[model samples]
Target: MTVLTEPGVDAAASAPVLPAGPSQNARARRGAPSWAWLGLVPFAAYVILFLVVPTVLSVGSGFFTEDGTFTWGDVAALGDPVVVQTFANSAGLSLLTAVVGAIVGALVCYALLGMNPEGAVRSTVDAAAGVLAQFGGVMLAFAFIATIGIQGVVTVFLQDALGIDIYAGGTWLYELPGLVLPYIYFQIPLMVITFMPALAALKPQWAEANLTLGGTRASFWLRIGIPVLAPSFLASLLLLFANAFSSYATAAALASQGSQIVPLQIRTALTSETVLGRENLAGALALGMIAVVGVVMALSSLIQRRAARWQS
Candidate 1:
């Protein structure tokens, strides 16, 4: 069909069509919802000034040096053992946190199975978990310190009242194992929170059905519960891992500089710049972090889809 004879085209052709002139276009642009456009100015300003500008500068600056001289050394410098070790360690930690958190969270979810935990338990769990989970960086570190730091409440109580010394008892908060204590502390509650919904989704009827079919609690859990909750469990686990991996202040505050998490190294590089003015190292590290977060979310999505299938 010709454009002139096309049904909708012919119908519109009958109506008087207005033409735009330069003056009208200018006026239109000027009158165009000034407040709406004005409101966006601040947001746009932030995006341009901070996010876009900084990203561009970082990318551009990565190819330069502290003296504004161009060089390929910065990009090539990522091959350093320090960088490699940090990446490997962070990756391992991320995976470890994910697995540990997932298992713990799943168990917590399972334990609360078939219970009517609606009111106080639910609210308290939610509020407390929210507090602990959202409690990031320095605040979280301080909270742990208050609870378990040398002069912390638990430490003081153990030392004075029970004549016990956790520090002397080999609780090296500066060590990796000791590092996991706080990680686990936050992670256990996190796991319970992550798996609580999926666990509660396990109906008593399913258990009853299994038992009627001659399956014991252990067998039912093994066969039915495990398979059904696995995806959601994995999703939550990946989330925990990602969160723990990207974390900095909590680990820094709890451990020694020798413990050196990736984020901490990034911060140190940004602040000190003694490591070859390696803020691009920070950017490269950030890009890696973004990639990890994407992978975790994607895995979570995959697991969620699988869980949906299992439920079906």
Candidate 2:
């Protein structure tokens, strides 16, 4: 017996079927809620207000006169002998602190590497590092002054006990040299905080594998550890350099008499009534600082990218 189907029913069923669009669950998974971006709003606003706005104003002000007419004289002041010396001083101090801090901090990280990461000692050091790293500005300067300045606790004690005077040459604590110790003080902790993670990121499996190949500890470090950590070390060093270079308050508080560094030079330009022919010199000095810091940070970012390869 032959069966008869409804007209067009068999033909319609034979037509090719299209795939359905993504399900509601998948669409939901792919798209985030609009409110989720609210978290970034505060951070974006902060950058715009504090960093971007100030940088634009400071750098832009350099090219204009007090009358708001554009001129190159203020920027030309950067070539003044005093200004050049100040830049050199800042660069030298920053380099010294960065080198010393990076080495000492790397050693500390190495010492802590074998300790229990979650142990009391490690946790305490981490916490202390975080705090001390941020312990700069006038507070840090005051601490150093109290400890080692003329008639300071340590200075007095040494003079009385050993008949040795720290200020026999002069009161260096109030000079550019005084900044060295304070900068290094905070620089070390900052280094520890920044470099510790890179040191910790070193894989133990690599060490074991090295040993499996009959390599010694020193051999592994010399061949593997040093190479891998070099990028991170360099990056941290640049960060420390930037930190010291941009510091104003500590240097201002301690070395109040002279514009020996760029930051202090900017202060002098801004506050000194006797400053001649450079009304906007402060802005020019700030522009120079921005250039130096921008270059240093750019290098740091490039090095960090290289370091991230091994970290991952």
Candidate 3:
């Protein structure tokens, strides 16, 4: 076939033409639709009403005294001996639970990884973990009370069958030790959920490559595996710590006798009938808790970013 072209028309002119930038209306159409923004209204309203408002109120209340005059008295009161002890106890509990939970949960995740990914056992464990991780508050405390409290089934059985009385050692079930058990119970499951994806992200080829180089299993882990998973592990640990730090209902239900932890102390400050002008103190305590949680979460986010690079 013969074709003719104009002298000034280059072959490039035959190529398909593309539009310059989109028009204002076209750009507007490409942007989020009105309904999409509308979809976020409920969530935005929720955050403003619940999170933003409460945080503002708590932080603002902390900076004021009974006479509505600004003061640092409430914040300074956080340094009181009893308050300091409460914070120390809370930190200790969070650290203990986070460490234990990370260890146990990582072990559990490793075990799951060894199983068939599609197997019922792995599915069941994941499902159970999802449920148990969120299983806290009054119900969890009641479960513990029924199982291991002074007159609990296990306690009663041990006392009757083996002459071993759990409470004979001064009823430790209502103390810090008691709180630790329940906190760990929930913490482990949460750690499992948070750490599993990181564990799964470990490609088999890495280990195979290590073996190709005659690396021992222990050496492979000590060199590559540990280093690769460290960030995720640390992030999960921080999350567990924050989770334990902010927990309230389980501790409240168990430790009814005293405010051994910061959350309990805040509760006492806010609710004690005999105490007056402690509401501001409660706000101060909440602000401190917020700061601790904020730092932990921030660290977790940084670690997660580092982990994402490797996982990707």
Candidate 4:
């Protein structure tokens, strides 16, 4: 009877549970396909080396003193006007770009989803969008330069043939609009790619049902379609903002100076007299970008959760 007494909690805690199902368990336990994870290694390494490391270094560097000693001035200077202004500009532009790109992209995807576009048209459009979305930084800047530079084909035509003095009175090449040209270029493609999945999730029967229920097209779209698609749209938009705000080469290629984006500021700080101190500034700026991206991702997740709740 004494031997039959149960052991302590630690002994019971060592017990294992039965498998729920062959197909339902997680990959590690169920011996599921490893392709996804196997493929993820290189991609993950790239992200860790390039993106994550840089981000951590930038944020941590801000807290460390120039001589490898640490201080709070880096964190404390988070409130600097120039720092504040750069973030404000970045946040505002990112928000604006995300919103605009999301709307336009969703609409475009929706239109395409409904359309049975075939062959050349579909391939051509897909190719073009892919190129634009994947294209950024220096390559995009150079493309913009080639298309609309001082001696660019379009610029030359606009100036010489049309006698348009846009470059004369308005050097579109060295201004906010110039930066916007590339932003819009990349932003639209991001929206298009991000929305494609959501659009695919859109069941035509849902639209049909709504319309059958005496709901007008606009009402169905406003009440139903948008609610479902909002998360994807917002996520993509935020991504666009992140891409645009983090972008350095394109902006640098576009503007000689005075734009003063936070990333560019960080790059400039690298070459500053107080390079050590400025690296901290650069770190703070990066943390700000991460915060922006985090906020956007969180918001989209919330929207998705709310949508699910409403559905349930």
Best by lDDT: 3
Candidate with the greatest TM-score versus the true structure: 2
* Candidate 1, superposed: residue stretches over 4 Å from native: 1-72, 161-163, 169-171, 203-205, 255-259, 310-312
lDDT of 1 by residue, 1-312 (tens): 534455656667676678998999999998876666687888999999977786666556567666777776665655788877877787777677667767776665555554557766656766787677666666766877788888899989998999989888675766565557667667767878777877777778998999899999899879988888777777778778877887777787766466366777777767773566467666665555566677888888888887776455
Off by over 4 Å in 4: 1-44, 117-119, 256-259, 273-277, 304-312
TM-score quality measure for candidate 2? 0.91
lDDT of 2 by residue, 115-192 (tens): 999999999999999999999889998898889988689999999999999899998888988889999999999999
For every model shown, what is its TM-score relative to the native structure?
Answer: 0.71, 0.91, 0.90, 0.78
Global CA lDDT of candidate 3, please?
A: 0.92
lDDT of each: 0.72, 0.91, 0.92, 0.72
RMSD of 4: 7.9
Model 3 CA deviation exceeding 4 Å by range: 1-35
lDDT of 3 at 131: 100
- Tens-place lDDT per residue, model 4, 25-48, is 665565755566787899999999
Error of 2 at 172 (Å): 0.9
lDDT of 3 by residue, 187-248 (tens): 99999999999999999999999999999999989999999999999999999999999999
